[model samples]
Target: MSDPLRETDENVVPQGIDPLRATIRTRFRRGELARAYDWCLEGLKHYPDNLWLKHRAVLCLTRSGALERAQTAYAEFRLHEAHYDAECRALGARLLKSEALEAPLSDFTIQAVRAAEAYAAIYQETCSYYPAINAASLFVLGGQIERAQPYIQAVLEQSENAEQDDREGAYYLHASRAEAFLLRGDMQRAQASLEAAIALDPDNHAARSITLRQLRLLADHLTLDLTGFQALEPPRPAHFAGHLFAVGDGDNQMTALDEEALRVRVREALKTAGVGSLYGSLAAGADILVAEAAHDLGLPFHAVLPTPSRVFFETSVRPVSSDWSRRYDACLEHAASVQEVTSDRKQVGDLHLNYASRIAMGLARIQAAALCTRPLQILLWDGQDNQADRGTAHDARLWRLSGGEQVHLDVPSRVRYRGAGNEGETADTPHFSQSLRAMLFLDVMGSSSVPDDRVPVFVDAVLGRLARACEQFAPGLVYQDSWGDGLFLAFESVARAAEAAVTLRSEFEAIDFEALDLPASLALRIGGHFGPVHEGRDPIQRRQSLFGSQVVTAARIEPMTLPGSIYVSESFAALLALEAEKAYRCEYVGRLKIDSQKQRQPIYSLRRLRRPETSN
Candidate 1:
């Protein structure tokens, strides 16, 4: 057997889903259901691996009044396989909703009974509100009203406790309540619930469509029934032209000709994939060429440095070429930001280089995952495993986990080259853009005073407590970083981020100092801020680091808080005020100036509203 794809292969097949977004809505709304259905079927032929389009095809077919065809396609959906998880099962249950409406299923039919059982399974596995509602709908449709009422009651109890700020969660909760009311022929209550659901997510196409249909049916004194499909927003991975790439090379110092050859390969791959950004460390060989190519294209090139700037420059950078330091400086100058892991001077050994490469790859993975795109790796090696230099081979394994293809730029001894890339260019200025997100900063107050032998135990205990606190409050902690006694975390919403800060204070209070620290001064001071952050890699650390004004605001607010208390910026307070399940109260602390150039920002002290224990 021989490998079909090689290092120089340029034939690239792009995976893009963004085109289907507007197409589905436009075609369906125009009453062009057949065309929409055809488009989906044709797309799946070319892209047979696209599960989303297959699901879309079934929905379009069902909506077009082709019941039998839709049912067959739905049954054959790949999601029904044993390998898919509860979430995928939930999606299937959701898609089945529309077809069930036009079914006119009788009480004695096998299909009707099986439909009800499937919904039950989905509800049991996911604990999602919609599935429970759908199960009740099935029972009601089969003239089993008594069985339906209990599910409605369960929904009411859960709705009272559900977090209202979860846009998607709240949408399903209110919509399901509407479905229950509709089943009972209570049009008034049903209409009100639908209105509430639509208010939560104005962009929800299904909610709007169903609401309009319900209004028309109510005016004509027609009976209400579900269309079957929940039509909540479908989860789609990102489809972008550009991919983040990594550069790794052997210990063999690449010559000027090797650098030029590498540049040609990198440039071709970037052009072929239409890459928008680059992420990696800046060593003498392949790294410099890729960086140069990325810079030439006016793309965002991020440089991840493994150690302190001067030490890294002194050993790994400057020694390669006196002019290499200037190129390194140029890369830093052009960067949107710089992350320095440690300032301590150390040898720029192979181990550090290996560690640095891993970090760079991690950053690339984070970027690709965030956009729902596959990560890419670009290796600079001759495809030889002579020694465990831990550069190209390690990257190849990492590339598989990252989920993308690779372009190996072979560095042979005899290689031809065109004119070399400019090694010195410092005149260029950087253009930067970063999205806003909520950040929480927690600094353990004075853990450094602990004896040298006890420091590790103290740090471990603090980290353990922090982990437990996050699991309690922020169930899905997305990003976190730490150094010494300080910890930094990031979240997509203000509610969870704020809850984490408040929970840390409350949870720490319940901890007795006698057990772990043997000191009373050890306490946690927390701060929270909501604003924009550049979620990119720290050049020194190699992993993703959150930075910018928001991060600075959070770090500054942390120290201002009273020991064992949480402080949040007014921006955070504004967001907390919007949450229906607000777990804490904030009293204005006053405006405090952090620095001379920075304006004085208002701060609020947060206190937890203890949750009452549920009666079992």
Candidate 2:
């Protein structure tokens, strides 16, 4: 659709000083909700009363699946603003609709009806086809077809009369018409309108995704056939993994001919999978081959390196051949984005590669979710599960556990590679006990504002609850410490860390601050990171302590996190994806500069997934 904020700017901010408006709009349109939300927050800091920015901020939260936060923000916005415009009202209704969709079955129809009325009221005030179509759809979903007829008729008439000069507007208009026809039980016209809508903006995957979902919902409710829409589905994002060629091994080493043949197979598999984007490392052998195929197909390649580029090149690329090294360099140069899972200057063990592979898979899944599609895993394997710790075998198994479609290209049995061998370690390299661990840092918000008299109450009510919760996870705790309002915890696994974080939040939220004579604003901000860390005995604490740059990174992430929310580093989220994909949900919250050094990391808001009920 045309920019709603731009059209309404005259009623909000002055034209000359509103340069941030365009940037925010562009980011939001590109599905970068976190970045757009950050920009909106920044704009509001300068112009606190800017209605457009407030609306956009709430919109970002709603789109990012932070419905509770979005509801709170919209409530606060309404408290500050005297008037509610059509856009603001529509936004509130959208929030209601989103929540209604997730409501329990017994409560869903009532909530959906309420949301439908809210949208209908907006449609009545503005004669907008967007809200009218939504009202009709929600009514139909709520089993109020008789009540939906008027709104459906209104949507059809208004959408037909609407201007179609703007491509986005035209697309939505057609989509609205399609929905209205479907509601009227005219399947043929609905399909034609849907096709027209898709034809108008074929490249706008986000918009097409919305249309597809609405149509699917209508088809499900009406028991209509929707198999014809399968062809319009968006291309899936992919994660790739394979063996790194072992150099100077004459017996089973892959020759030039084998490499070329493998590249052809990789390209064919990518094409057959209909992959729009690729995520993986850029190491020599199969990784480089996949990157080259992605580049040739004009697909975006996101490279996830286990360690720093120089170290990865030295260990994984340079050992193969100069030609392979050059190929790796070219892939890096052409990569859409390159993210290092850790800042380690040297490869420590198989942990780094394993971590990077999981991160790549998680990122691809994230991208696919955003596009309303599935993630595909492509592996080059020889049907052998030799390597147990880290290799193509381990990655393939992880993918299977995560429950996704995978394509395996069979490598010749003669291709013997040094899978997770000690090829990267040198004699001079000192080895210390190292393992991948999840670190958590938590700080109490507004701790300084607490009166000294109430400090005892805070200690009893707040810190006490945190201590009790940590005790429940004692078996998984690697290290734990608390001082004043700050707590640091190390967990043996990402699953444990995630469970602990969520449990702590739940425990704290259950506390009664008002009854304890403490500030109601008191809440905890938590941050987590997963990476290889040095485990050693502490001289001061007289206990085992976890220390490394990763721990420092986790500490930096805490101060930036929103109060009462758990924000984790990308590595932490990736581990959760591999180990606890079915138990936790990680929503991308954009990249943030975590320190004064200007180092940035992608952050995700973590929460537990609701379990499905079992039928008796």
Candidate 3:
């Protein structure tokens, strides 16, 4: 018979064998777990003897929420006294600890003992090694690392006989050794052992955890950040939760920002941060501008804006906020109120004090209420304050209202200010203040043709591309709405919004047209407007937008425009004054009436290109 395993490529396996193992190795490298999991199950059936197959299956299954299956496979794998018995024992112990297993299984302990014996038996005969290493991890997990030192020393003495891949095993022994050092309060050796382990495997999660835990213990007993301390390993994901707050004052302060300024600020920020996520507070005057930036960039947004009454703000994208949990990436609330025709609608409402603060507070409360309705992970705040006397003595009271624990603020708690700082203060805080000026709204002219099934993928592609544009241009200011095609945006200035629009037009035209499955001639029509309006949700209109005639005019621009063209309202043009004439070719497009008016309205079309014929 042809070799069963060799019938397929050494890389590939025959049917009825674990195809998932091959796929898992591929996806693990590619970081595509979902598809890998699907293939892993198929592989598991045919190659039960393959240790690599079993390991990958358990990992993928656990990651994919088939935890029960993972646990079962783990248990079964433990039954076999394989060459990787020690590693298998450590993994099983970690799994058991994670699941809070109450009773110890005889098979589990028996397998662990057998594996330890196998290693010890090998160690006694190893003549090439100076130090011996053994099953120290068993003692570490069993809370008796001190008792495991003899075994670890024996394994280390024979380490030369083991391969380089056995370094992790040595580190496992070191981890237990470090724990022993700590138990004896021998800080120097504990630190040295951890350092050695880390030197072997930088991504050693176990070593990293123990090192930090030991450092924290030392800090509790001694002064932190002392002469010999290197910042407690890098802060992990688990460290940030409950230690941060997303705080900002309602500074409606970008009024004088021109298009150049908007682009400059955004561009500079991105260059500095590379790829950072923006979390703009909706109550800030920059909300609309940020949304416009995001729309122009084609990025997903986590809108924390609050609507008046209970109405959900209607948008083209499901607006998610840091409500419910840090993982709440998509909008959860249903339509509570939607303003319809026949009933007047207002998008902008009153400009209240601490608008941004109120919005943030409301977000906290919404998350809190939701948690009460359904138990979920603990919520956290992002921004933080350090000075105890800054009058803003960390709003601990906010947690009670939100009905959830406050997220720890780990990323230094400095106030975010736009302008100048006090004399002699650090250069980090600049001295220029900005004012809020205009809002830009973008709506896809005709989106009915987009197939519903492919909407999400297409939208993600488009929005992801736009997000890149924002990163290239605007950094911290952008928002995304839920309309598959339509996007609502706001900006600090008509000029920046216009610049963004022009850039957006050029970008859309230059997009990977093939990826969108559109003809070569396919393009996008974008509309924009600038005006003085309320930035937050309208309380009186139940969060319905109350944009003045400017919005309606801007909306009309798209309908009257061509694909891949940027449309701007006359009001925005006037704000530009002579500056507008220099940047764009302005022309009188005659007069047109808008949504709420019976009288004809005067409109002007500003094109970067002078001749309309050339544009066509």
Q: In lDDT terms, which candidate is top? A: 2
lDDT for each residue of candidate 2 in 154-173, tens digit (9 for 90 to 100) = 88887776787877778899
Query: lDDT scores for all predictions?
Result: 0.57, 0.79, 0.40
Predicted candidate 3 versus true structure: per-residue lDDT over 1-616, tens digit per residue: 2322211232344454434444455544332333344445446566556666666656654433233445776777653456455445444544443232212343434444444444444445542121123334344334445655776555444432444556555655555455445544566776776677666765443334434543443334333332243322421110001221223333321223332354344434332322112222322122333333433443322343323212213221122222212222122211111111111132222221112222333322222111111111122222444542211123334323334333222222232222211112111224321223344445444455556775675576765566566555453244334355655666665656767777766666677746776444545766665443433444665553434444455566666554555545544544442233335543333234454554333344445632111100
Off by over 4 Å in 1: 1-258, 348-351, 385-390, 402-404, 413-616
Give candidate 2 misplaced runs (Cα > 4 Å): 1-58, 68-85, 102-110, 141-143, 160-163, 181-193, 213-228, 246-258, 419-421, 425-432, 449-454, 610-616
Error of 1 at 61 (Å): 37
Per-residue error (Å), model 1, residue 519: 22
Off by over 4 Å in 3: 1-50, 59-70, 75-147, 155-180, 203-207, 210-230, 238-251, 255-616
Best candidate according to TM-score: 2
For candidate 1, lDDT tens digit of each residue in 440-482?
8888887777778877777667667777667654444668877
Candidate 1: what lDDT?
0.57
Candidate 1 backbone collisions, by pair = 97-228, 97-229, 98-227, 98-228, 98-229, 238-372, 304-539, 305-539, 305-540, 436-532
Output the better candidate (1/2) by TM-score.
Answer: 2
Task: State each candidate's clash count.
Answer: 10, 0, 74
